[model samples]
Target: MKFFRNQIENKKDKSKKEDLAGASASASENYHSLLECLHHTGELKSQSLVINQLKFMLIYLETMADPEKIQKLILPALHKCMSLADLDECISSAGSVKTQSTREAADLLLEGYCLITVDTCSEFWLLQVRADIHRPPLEPENEKVVRGSHIGFVEDMAVNLRMIRQRMANKKLVFRYLTKGKETNTKIVLAYVKGIADEQVAETIYRKTEKIGADMIFSPGFMQEFMEEHPYSPFPQFLQTERPDRVMANLMEGKVAILAEGSPTTIVMPVTFFSFFQSPDDYNSRFLPGAFYRILRLISFVIALVLPSVYIAVIAFHFEVVPSDLVIPLKTSVSGIPFPPLLEAFIMVFTIELIREAGIRLPTPIGQTIGIVGGLIIGDAVVRAGLISNMMIIVIALTTVSSFSIPSVEMSASLRLLTFPLMILSSVFGFLGIMFGLMFIMIHLCKLHTFQSPYLEPVAPFTKTQYKDTFLRFPIRKQHKDKASEAGGNKANK
Candidate 1:
């Protein structure tokens, strides 16, 4: 209780300080007001420089402001200037120079821009000197492709935008920027192709994005949760990817992408259920091979979501479905097992999930070792100890492999999570329960929408034209033989 009281007292003290700072900031006298507002902030820096007999004060955030740019370019050029006109002429090459009010100046300072103030000047110039700190674009670990460009989006928004623009030279591509988060003030960019993109969808996304007023937004996921229509749904509506090429492709398909300043992943909006199943390899490989793998992935999705449940249902309640040839072996395998199918399935599934999660969180070499031990050693020991049957182990292994085949990490996770409920339902009602669960998921997918675009596009509404590239990849162009050449009909030109 004393600790709680102390915490409350500390918060009250902070609030009082903020109120005092706010009151002091509004009382004009520019320089004093700025200093008072920045009080208690240790990173606030002020430098005094003289240029041609005129005294000036430059204020900025030390951590965000670039020292080399300030000392080498700004100060040296300003030292030779005689007046505001000369100052403007000298610093014309410096990008984004503007005169701002006190509030705007304060915001600029925090963004790494130096606020330049003369002794008697009422307004101050805000110069861009923000530090460039970002990781170089590296191939995404999860979205790897063998034949396509490996470069992926970095945390830097400007660099990510440049990567897209570098590949797509179309002038119609547009970027609409908005600032979200009250405390963080994170920069977000909504990118789309002008004529090709659905204007209504773009407008809806922009409106919803602008409406976000969170105190802090750290990632694309934050924006997604805040604005997605069905936030409670396990399946992700917006497709997130780190590849700039993927963003460009989606833009061409009339989809919009949302990029957050500090996030490496960007979200493509109005995506279909099939969109998450696609990979860069689909376009890079031959059409037949691509379509084959695409169909295989779809099958994998079904298998991942229902195979274990089907096994449980059949063994527990519908053992007659088993073929006579395999029934003896199946019976022998389960005869030694002590627990019922439901409990046995749950235990093994939970163990697989635990191992998979630990493998991800641990370092790579150790993770691989753990996977080998858990999958081989632990699994073998459990079967020998009669805790689980060999057939159950096979079902779990196939389920794990199938889930890993999904291209999107979010989609894969959702499929894995849905497995538990389906398993429970199937254990209760056998094949009937599995059918009911599938029906509900289908209905949910049909009802889901992103920015008013159907979630199950080309399937629910059934557009045949999109099928050329949806489940299959068709060649971009094919030459047609001229009938005139074959039949010799055009004699006039000859």
Candidate 2:
């Protein structure tokens, strides 16, 4: 019985070898056909070499393939080689592969691999000769921190993933890659903790990204507009950050991060409205200072969004709300203004926006000068010209400062944007219009969802457990033991 089993196993092995040989033959034929298909392209380079009287065809893309490697490294090694097997053995000095599928071989060529096809052998070899050219990782201009890792992500996806892996060093950290953009073939990586991340949320995000059919995906911000639940909404659903520490922190909390090649910024998903308000600087400091700054940022959010509107409402129709003592000066300041409250407010706000934008677009040294000189000159000139009131200037200046206090630039910009509509409404109907605008914003926040997780989060759905980390940071020892729960996976309402 043992002899019979041995004989049957030998036959199976023989059959497997035969099948592999047949497949290789077909692959070689298909590879020739693929070469013919690409023959018309001017960059398709080919060279012939004879080793032990056997003719071999070497093919590569001229633009991407390294000529130095082919001449200095590859040819010297292949000179004495007679067969594909020997060639493979010699090329072990560098990364090379023997592939059978023609489609795969073509793909390898695109990736800067040199293909060697021997006339006598069915299997072909692909040699790696990719030239890497990219800028070194530098501190991101937008996400500078007072304390923490100064190294930020560069445009290279491999380097970004390496940095992240070095920090995490966890087996559960899974990075699933996908190629979007039909024309650009842009690569995107979705990273999450396998067991910690909510499976449903991750799967939904994966499906949405996979379903994207755009012709080109340029950057992380460009891709974000497509993946967000509400493109029409001013608020950003995903938090964008250049800090790998922030990305790793979010991953530990079971949130998924999307990283696109050619983009330094990465997107963190299933974020709450509060997520943008929090910054890496917060955790870098002591609990007391971090919590205090966190609270201050939240207050800034309110002040930035409503300060101008409140000013408009009070001066236009709700003057009784102001203290009687200050009313005289306020009235005197506005009495000389040539326009109504809304028009005056709009002129000052528009001028500020223009100055801010110009300052940003100018060079740093020039931008500071522009911001200081332009602001002082414009503010003083407008006040003297009676085009805008001194009180309105103060209100607008406060509003700008409050908006600037928010850590996230996108959120700060959105807050600034909401100011305009509220100002308009408050100008017409005073307090009632302001209330309506607030209600509309609240309803919009409640209706918004990120990966099916509520945007308003603990506040709207009333999840008491999450309050520990919401508005305030609790003591470190008071954190929940189940780290995944902090992700708010189950606590969140759809």
Candidate 3:
């Protein structure tokens, strides 16, 4: 208890920043001082001077949460007598992963989770309660590539941060934890390559991030929403991936990654458009196979986005271009069906969506069984009963399969929801309507910026050198397998 007191009396030079006391006390007075200052709230530009009012102190320390673990242990205020606290046990019981004592003495036994107290009774209790929650780890739902790492990001922040830290060997891979959400005190990590990441980008993150004052920064998705520069764009300007490999790749490219404490996925900023369609396996696998997968993903994206609208165009307005032989088969299938081509398409689309939603919301085993039965019984029974044409069934199936082909599940889901409007447009202006809609979407994408970089980087800006890693996975080194081994994965692809 006396150790901290001695250090405070003799150690501080009073020149550089000191842990200035809020009061000059008898050292016996009962007072509260905020401890283990994990974060700063209220104001960024506040004065650093300490105010001594009566017997109280509100000392602010750089290291807040677990104060005992701090490396430099010159506690000049340790001489005050108190009982030794089982602080670690209490904190762990409080459900935190690890807890460190903020101060040395037990009687003056106190650390500021919010405020630590001295000369007080033992009734001082801990503040802040965090419920551990996050999304489950699953395969990358949207950006699935066969050759990549299988695990996806879960909602737990610590777990997610660990995933990022595990990959990089460089100490320059830095993480700074900041607390936000005035009530929630939600933790967020700012990550970057100290040397590789642009200095301005880190500063920009710090500036914008500190301004956030939500009641509860509970979700990574929610935090990302508040912190990002643009809010209304239809296209995602940042790359939000659960895959650590993808994060490592972005780190290598000098991009910043932000992980909120509760969200399963972290977000990478200043993402180029070409980066969104990419998968980690594109760089991990052989170049030729990687290129093949990239082309497949690109094709799938194009199909998911435009196929139905194209179908509506051809069937409604370009039927004259259809060969006579195929037309008879199509006519025969729809012979008893009373609806127009557009109306029939709508009905089919609506039915498939209902089944998909049901499949996803239900439990896994039940959902799988339901999906099988729903697809077989519903589609086959309806066709057999002559309610809808066989050709209509085929179109809906193609759309569903193509929609799943997208790598990021969120993107796929977005594509699915967007298809209905495009379908309607196709019925109105045929291919021209689809073209108009697509052009508008593209403009939104190009206008979007992730962490100040062109969302469509390497494309909007047309960087030929950057393409060495985009779409096509080039070798780690042009010559020598030893160089490939030395460089780890393909540096160009990064």
> Which one is best on TM-score?
1
TM-score of every model versus the real structure: 0.89, 0.85, 0.70
Off by over 4 Å in 1: 1-32, 94-96, 478-494
The digit string of per-residue lDDT tens for model 3 on 407-436 reads: 666667777777888888889998889989
Q: Please give the lDDT score at residue 222 for candidate 3.
A: 77
State which candidate, 1 or 2, has the greater TM-score. Answer: 1
Error of 2 at 480 (Å): 4.8
Q: Alpha carbon lDDT of residue 224, candidate 3?
A: 70
Between prediction 2 and prediction 3, the one with superior lDDT is 2
Alpha-carbon local distance difference test for all models: 0.85, 0.84, 0.64
**Model 1 lDDT per residue over 1-494, tens place:** 99999999998997675454421211234556676566648787788877777777778889999999898867877877878667667666646556545566777788888777776555576778999998979999899998889999999999999999999999999999999999899999999999989999999999999999899989888888888889899898989999998999999989999999999999999998999999989888887888888888999999999999999999989999999999999999999788988899889889998998899899999998998887898898998798999999999999999999999999999999999899999999999999999999999999988788888888888865566666766654421133234335446556
Model 3: lDDT of residue 321: 70
Backbone clash pairs for candidate 1 read: none
